[model samples]
Target: MMNKGRLYGVGVGPGDPELITLKALRLLRSCPVVAYQSADDKESIARGIVAEYLPGNQIEVQYHLPRALDPYAAQPIYDEVVIPIQEHLAAGRDVVVLCEGDPLFYGSFMYVFTRLSDHFETEVVPGVSSPMGCASALAVPLSYRNDVFSVLPAPLPAEVLEAQLLNADAAVIIKLRRHFTKVRDVLHKLGLASRARYIERGTMANQRVVSLDDMDPSQVPYFSMILVPSKSHL
Candidate 1:
């Protein structure tokens, strides 16, 4: 019997290819197969990030995980998409599943990781997450000593977001594509609008930093973020 191949879930960083770690780059290039997920109609963001570095000899596999679905309803589809990666692993071909940010941090790679890690040898490489990337681009300090930090998904109810904001010293409001206006209103109501920096495609080549009021809610993209920095200063 052939030995099974090792599985790698490598975080490619928020958007910048430069942010990929040395270890991740090594594993990514050495792997016999490279994989990432995207919609049938869209190009893979993860693949685009590292397209320059690929040796062009590795077998590339692209899977599709639809945007915004009921996870329960999407489970079967998710399960189905990962079968190709599993087949490569079973054939003793090492597969590197590329993720946008940290693989386990609300990453789509989690779908593959959860499915394949149990059956094969697995490894995960950490990368720069969105909060950190956005904060750097904004040049704002996120948290001070003992300051609480919160990651609030914009999909949550306004009341719930408000309550969470009231408790944390700093926060990053994400998943704001369709919920930008709601999050903007909450920030204004909570008097955090001034401190909240709105950026779209943060750290990407076409990155845009716009004021909260200036943002066109309808034009918001999936990669946008709102960074609320801590008020405390040393």
Candidate 2:
């Protein structure tokens, strides 16, 4: 009987190629099939991060799990995207799936993990997530001693965001694309606008750190983040 292939969920880190971990690189190269999230026209960010390291002869699979949809309603969609990865594993060929950040930390790989972990051997490699990457790029401390930190997605309603901010000493605002104006207004109302720092594509070659107040709402990208660092100083 042919043994089933092992499945690996490898985190490629934020955007910098050097951010890839030794373990991730090892498995990434050893796997016969490499899978990543991709759009019809654009290369996946996860793949782009480690493009130079790819061996070039391995079979590559691209899957897209659409965003902004109801989770319950997206089950069939998630099932459909992972079919390519499952087919590779079924053939007894080890597969390495690339994730932008830590696999469990709001990663796209979750779709694959939830569906395949029960049927196949699986491993996940952690990588530097957006908040940590942005904090380093901004050269600001994320939290001080005894400080509470929170990750607030920008799509959240103003009242909900305000409440979360009220309790957090430090916060990272993510997914700011279309919700930038709403989040900006909420931060101003809570007197946190001045303390917030904005950046786009942190740790990448095109990284840009912009003052929060000066950021144009219409121009915010999916890779942008707002860091509200702890006020306490050492």
Candidate 3:
């Protein structure tokens, strides 16, 4: 029997076509099977990014990852999610799974990769992450010389968030949608609200960037991200 085929976990970059790396674009164009995640719809942002590079009538697989408040409860959903792709890999078909931002950065690719590793060869191509793109879209530096950067989930407790802000030279808080108001309160309490900046939709066409003080949560989308650059260390 032929060896099980390799898997290409391609990062489609952060909401921009040109941002895709040469390596990722090349792989997508060459792969017979291209896969991506679809949430509540058949198409997705990540899929749109690589659409140009894909072959006509090529095999396109959509893996549906469960959208739940808790990642643990969603484990079973993901297991069921990758089964079709796994089946393709087992049949010796090289599959390219398109992911948003970087494959390893808070992405679904990691979940599938971890479970499918024993059965097939998997390669992850790093792409520009959302935070970096968010920073770039604002024309601001995420970190300066000797600056420390910490990435934390927005759902972190108020105290934990405060302590992290106190120590890091710079910090990025992701998943800012549900926790936006809480994160805003913590920043305000720590007197860091003025220094904070929010970017919604990152590098996408509808992206928005502004100082935290001026932001209205109602205007922010679920894809929103916030950055707090340390002014004290300057």
How many pairs of residues collide in model 3?
0
Backbone Cα, N, C clashes tallied per candidate: 0, 0, 0
Give Cα distance to truth, residue 147, candidate 3, Å: 2.0
Candidate 1 residue-wise lDDT, 86-164, digit = tens = 9999999999999998999999998899999999999999989989999998899999999899999999999999999
- Across residues 1-234, which tens digit of lDDT does each residue of candidate 3 receive? 887878999888788788999999889988878888887755778988777767786798888786554878888888888998998899888999999999998888988998998778888899999889888888777788888899988878979999998889899998877678889999899888888888888888777777787777666666788888756544
Query: 13-70, model 2: which lDDT tens digit per residue?
Result: 8898999899999999889999999778888999999999999999999999888789
TM-score of each: 0.98, 0.98, 0.92
Cα shift from native, residue 118, model 2 (Å): 0.1
lDDT for each candidate structure: 0.93, 0.92, 0.84
Model 2 gets an lDDT of 0.92
Candidate 3 regions with alpha-carbon error over 4 angstroms: 69-71, 232-234
Q: Where does candidate 3 clash, by residue pair?
A: none
Query: Comparing candidate 1 with candidate 3, which one achieves the higher TM-score?
Result: 1
